[model samples]
Target: MRFFIVISSLSKLLKYMYYIYTHSSMVEGKRCMQTNESSKEQKVKVSGLTFAQLKKWVTVDLGMKPYRAQQLFSWIHLKRVISFHQMTDISLSARNRLDRAGEITALESCDTIAADDGTVKYSFALEDSEVIESVLIPDSPRLTACLSTQAGCRCGCTFCQTGRGGFRRNLRTDEIVAQLYGLQSSSNDRITNVVFMGMGEPMDNFPALSDALSIISDDRGICIGARKITVSTVGIPGGIEKLTQLDGQYGLAVSLHSAVESTRLKLVPVAKTLPLRELKRDMKDYISRKGRRITLEYCLIAGINDSLEEASALAEFAGDIECKINLLIYNPVEGAPYRRPDTESVNRFMHYLYPRCQAVMLRRSRGSDIAAACGQLGPGARND
Candidate 1:
């Protein structure tokens, strides 16, 4: 009876912890919403707003000069300053006024790990104490920063560690932008490329992602060109359409783990409603409108989606569209049932896929030893 009571108490404690961990973000969001509902003069979070929005906020809302917005924007984004006092050129009085009327928000970097292969993973704590990860992959000329769009993930891809962790909350625009700037501050190299392929699905947080893209690509600020950034999605509904409507030519990569619809359904559960046919149509539309080639990412998992027939199916799927194929080897994750294909299987699969694809490249897996590879990112994946 004593042992059973102890076990029951432990179970209840675990359940309570899980509830607090998962629901805090949402509860905090609701609390903020309620607090802000009645207050019209609440301080604006300056980090996330675009220059135009900042200009309006300063001039109309704060009764300041328009050019100050440019100065503030450059400081918040280019300089990566967290406090208004860091804006050296701005008049002390203006800085004081800005501090009173608005605030610069930033993600707190909790843990960092550098892999043997020069892949650095950064873990950040959100306001609600939810944890998310970003990765800095060093590619000499182009240091790429992998930013997360949401805290956890709603798209339950069976092979992805992030998906298995389940959903927490969609990150705000500021949180999305802060990841790039956060990584930039930590590394010696300025990020030349940005990939929204870390903790959450980008399309699920489209509004924030859209705003972040504009701010990141804007010449007035951090100014990483749209072409240098890639937004990867698991083919969520209306996501491609929304991207098509956006102004910039930011690159798009689809996580097409399997070309066979049935297989994809099993792997990426989100693909059930948004089938391969619909996804193809959307991709075609994006190419037609954007005039940019798409990138198809295929992770070869042993006995899952890695086979001669799978390659054939992939070739057939890409045959109609203009896209480059990036074949990635499945990276090992704790508690995942999937296995990386053996050397012979991978070789055979690539050989069969090479000529059939519009363009084919076997992307070398990076940071697998440190859990920073593709689809191997999440809060639980962090060493700390």
Candidate 2:
């Protein structure tokens, strides 16, 4: 039975490796096709297109005036109108044509659970009925929307519940943006900040994540400030390089739960593929070019990464880069072996890093009761 279990695990790993190899080529092929064909002719999501892309679809594909595109974009993004019929200024004929050609991707809120601390977790049902979770965290005078980039995570962080479910697929750009809009509409509060720190790694779904960032930060759309938006990743070097090339003052956060490679690899299985040294080099380059301080998110797990030695190593890792360290207590997930660090250990770890690190803050895990805290989103959650 032990040998059989080992073989089963090995087979799953091989399957995942094959998926990764083929997925890249598939994305590239799809991009080429999109560039060559008219977007309107393709069954594209209306919410995914930029103002410029919409304008091209309107003027070139639909044979309408360019001004109509601005009106359509305003209706969809600014007004947060979901239905084509609600676009009052757009002619009925055009609306009918649009209704037939494309769709506005929207997620239905199937379940909502609120914690005592005002953190609300939402399970949104996609059009296909697959569900993904997002959290709305309320800090006084600041409302932050935590959004997901993929349906489930592929990053096999041992402590993370989301990865235990395995990877489903990447969320479309519109699906990514819709979480913020849906949360704002439901809560009746303005989202002051948006963080890609839920469910999936933003870097793994770079194209969709990048497009979502563009739309959310666009002055003509949701218009959230680039500075207010933060994208967290498990230190993907290629994704960091791509983000640096983009034209925005976006915040970058790396999930470096441990500074030592051996410890990190044990915690985050994906770390073996992306070495700590290479990620730090990319992060340094990103900081140099952007002239901005990056954030390193470290989760303090009992008997795992929360130690005086680990804290010292982490401070040393943050030595070269301009960064702020956000130390989070591990939010326990069902069936996970790790536990949250005790108060004394947590305090000791923070104290050790205080002198060596420029800025270090111990962030309390919120919404744990509702299973909405960091690394606790997907275990036993209702999907249908």
Q: Count the backbone clashes (under 3 Å) in each candidate.
A: 0, 0
What lDDT does candidate 2 reach at residue 162?
93
lDDT of 2: 0.85
Cα lDDT tens digits, model 1, 1-384, are 999999999999999987775445333121233323433466677898988888877665555667778888889888788999989998887786677667778876898888988999888988789888999999888799999998789999999899999999999889899888888888777789999999999999998899899899989888999999999999999998999999998899999999999999999999997999999999999999999999999999999899899999999999989999999999877788989999999999989988877799999887888899998898566433
RMSD of each: 15.9, 16.0
Model 2 residue 21 CA deviation (Å) reads 46
Residue 310 CA displacement from its true place in model 2, Å: 0.7
Alpha-carbon TM-score of each model against the true structure? 0.88, 0.87
Off by over 4 Å in 2: 1-42, 381-384
Per-residue lDDT of candidate 2, residues 26-59 (tens digit) = 3312122332345456566889887778877765
* Candidate 2, residue 312: how far the Cα is off, in Å: 1.2
